[model samples]
Target chain A: MQTNISVDLGGTNVRCALVDENGTILSIVKGSSNPEKGAQAIVDKIESLIKQLDNYEQANAIGIVVPGLIDQEKGIITAANNLPKLIDYPLKKQLEQDLGKPVILANDVKAAAYGEAISGAGKEHAIVYYISISTGIGGAAVIDQKLLSGFHGFAGEVGNVIVDPHYEAIGIMNAGAAEALGSGTAIIRIGKEKLGQQIEHAGNVFDLAKQNQKEAQEIVEQMTDHLSTLLSTIALVIDPSIIILGGGVMKGKDVFLEALDQKFHAKIFDAMRDIRIEEAQLEEPGIVGAAMLAQQSVSH
Target chain B: MQTNISVDLGGTNVRCALVDENGTILSIVKGSSNPEKGAQAIVDKIESLIKQLDNYEQANAIGIVVPGLIDQEKGIITAANNLPKLIDYPLKKQLEQDLGKPVILANDVKAAAYGEAISGAGKEHAIVYYISISTGIGGAAVIDQKLLSGFHGFAGEVGNVIVDPHYEAIGIMNAGAAEALGSGTAIIRIGKEKLGQQIEHAGNVFDLAKQNQKEAQEIVEQMTDHLSTLLSTIALVIDPSIIILGGGVMKGKDVFLEALDQKFHAKIFDAMRDIRIEEAQLEEPGIVGAAMLAQQSVSH
Candidate 1:
């Protein structure tokens, strides 16, 4: 079986792993993707990680997943919020030259979704929606065994959909987006303001909710309402065979999931009452997805 | 050139036309779709109209468009709000048997989008989003030269996306949705209550706004804001090559378009500023789109 090197490149960290054709990780490695050191430093870090996974004869392809607006067809990072220097970078070409192997690049979320669809929780389903509710809410769709990439390669942008028209004028943008209400970033922002120095991270906030913190509970309830509304809308539109929810916030939050399911059911129309919503089953979904995408592209 | 008979079935009337390979209507006809009489009566009306276009020797296919959730693969109308008896009806099989030719059935809005993408405003565009702002805001998407029908065949439910989380409990569920704010149904309801019963249609409401009626202007302004936010969200997510706006409400309302463009530009991210937004140019876009869908499906 062919193997591939998958790299999940974020501003803070670059996670590298040797993944078999079946999406099993043989060995793992890591490095820093420090943008302050400039684009070349980031490229060098990726190259060093590839060297660390030195089974050159075994690996046939390299897949790199990054954040932001990417032109997958051109293998270029158009504009990334996290890595500003990566704008218009010909990542595929640079990586290929550095590693001397066939390389594929995609948006991090899209890669994660493809990974989930092929080998994770979405493996058994024909149509799946993979959503990441972390610092930001990101999503991707796999329909009829193909990723639904729209004209400009910006499909599955569920996070930007407006949820409040009246609030548009108040500079309160992204109110309808899942990221604005349910993301870890949103939770932390609200927590800091409501609980001040009492809460540091979203995980701590969730812990507070678990311990019956009124403010924490209030934020969690608001998050549930936003998530339920977003999921209900997705259900009505896509009616996917399965919805796979993942990210840091969803890892061990069973209570949040239960509340979200109840709210989602109440809002959905009768016709779409039977849709299945579940948690993704992958330790490093993004890395696995990036590897799978590389293998699939090379084979095709 | 081969010809096909396309029928647009609505609650009030039925419009039929003989369309050639180039999407030209050779002959046109019309009749009533009186649901009070029953489903069989509506079928008979359709058959009679096809007979009027008596060049059956040249016709090779039959296409029917209706307002409802359609099971495209089975060629069945799963549920039609207006024609309630159409539930679980094998519309294509029955029509094929009656006409002695292949028959195709599709959702009216999907057909309209097909027409726009193939020959109207969205011609040659790889990604096209067609939105019908009539009684309700219905939308459809064409991606990678194919329609995006989700797992349950209800993919283009754009109107269901939440627009307002707070207002969802009362006035209208999901206030951020375009249908909740910009649809003809919403307009009529809000118009009658605020501007009196004199403003019956969307056009009349626009005329009232031109006359500087405060309530009428407010309604149009609010509707524009809603439309702009929805369009911006779509742009941020899909980044379609072009957005084609159609339906009865947009026929003569130029001011609404201007306002919508302004709001959309203001809200969309800088990277997605180059997308084209245009008015649809198909005459009876829905009927033509249905015909195109039928032909495309049969050929495939």
Candidate 2:
């Protein structure tokens, strides 16, 4: 019966909601986070946004999900480009004091994974791995409805996973990182090279490929192979009951989903070829999962 | 207060031991399993070995660890190349009935990971990942002492994980599998081609490298770089507190461990640079882990 106020905090906007046990948002308020206004102002804006929730007072705890790395054990945002000024700030402690309630902070992807594992596509499975392919790629594993919080809250940072040691090297990331080779950013980058045009978005590449453009189709196939290698490698390591795919890349799922599945199965041992990869079912998994994470943490 | 019988069943030998609460081997016996003599013969051999233990009747349960795939949920050995005849046998039920105790079967790498996490090099860590570089590479992740058993029992089959989509291809494994690139078999394979000699063992290559053989050193470096890529990729996926290395390849640890660590750190994000890689500290992790698994399962 526990209820929670979940906030999906991103650079551009933040959504505060009151969530019930079934991951339904009971009441919600949304507004620009304006992280550029600096730490204290953004924090105050979040507090006001929470107060605007129709059933805010009924919430048992607050859970804020962020898009960047968090020093979870220390209750600080270690690195976030949008909220740079808040980096290393005692966000958890500061928010808890102002709200007068227990608070939980989780990585956005991890929270989404937890949400899906408990109430969405992964509800029937005990081991669920969630992968998000957007401008960049990220992932999280939810085992028995609990997120795999790595030693430093890096358990699901699969975007940086190296797919090949010899292929391509980008700044900071090693050559052939999954994010470098298969993410939305990678699609656009590869698209420009092959099509000799300013390909603005990954969707365009998918559309072109769907329209039977040989160049775009090659890029899509390249991305598919890169993802297949990454997924197959992760599957070997963790062996999730199911892997749920979400993110901007899923917009192109119709173009690449079947190919991705076939390529993934071809890479792993036959016994593991059955590990299902499906599109995420929740429309607002980040907020819902944040709420579930708070509810679970407080109840336990 | 619980005690159990742990059996490390390999194609070559079987070691049975009475394990006490602290993972101590109270009593032990070892001999060839003679798997070729057939499934029933091996089963009989195991039962006889258990009987040879000083306190066989005191065990509350039995845990057997095998090298190949298992249908852990069904308690069946699904595929073990060495014991081909026992592929679909009801090994767990047969053993339980014969020994009159509850039985649990686990993959060897997974059991070794449990052993290390429970009482060996990884005892102090909550998330322990074990990677063994033997004839082929295998790995397992033990989070809070429980192995991450995949949908089937293929969770720790890292050897078959493809490292690159375009590297050299082998039999059933996809092109550029971790085993094909970095295992002892790979080392010997690469050494033979470069040094123009039948390199009998990976250790000989390491020995020659130590003696300043240029071709051998290059092979060692190649293997080291492949391992670094593999480990760095894995670190991003799971972010374990500690990674314990075992298997026959560790015999050449002096030649490659330091370089492997340096290369591994170089490839990962700065935040994960501190993750430790250490040699496994168990003389017999297979038997010890199998025992701990039985003890934990029954108590739960």
DockQ of 2: 0.77
Using TM-score as the measure, the top candidate is 2
Go through the candidates in order and give the C-alpha RMSD of each one to the true structure. 3.0, 1.7
Name model 1 segments beyond 4 Å from true. Answer: A31-48, A51-55, A58-60, A80-86, A98-100, A165-177, B34-37, B51-60, B168-177
- Enumerate clash totals for all models, in the order shown: 5, 0
- In angstroms, how far off is B23's CA in candidate 1? 2.4
Model 1 DockQ (Cα-based): 0.50
Displacement of the residue A26 alpha carbon in candidate 1, Å: 3.8
Chain A TM-scores, one per candidate?
Answer: 0.90, 0.97
How far off is residue B66 in model 1, in Å?
A: 1.1
Candidate 2, residues B151-182, lDDT tens digits: the string is 77667788887666568687777798888989
Q: lDDT by residue for model 2 over A1-300, one digit each (tens)?
A: 668999888899988999999998788889998988888987898999999987678788988999887887678888887889889888889889998878888888888889989989999998889999998888988887778988877887888888876666877777889999999989988898888676999998999999999999999988998899999988888888799999988999999999999988888777676789999999989899989988888888
Q: TM-scores for all candidates?
A: 0.91, 0.96
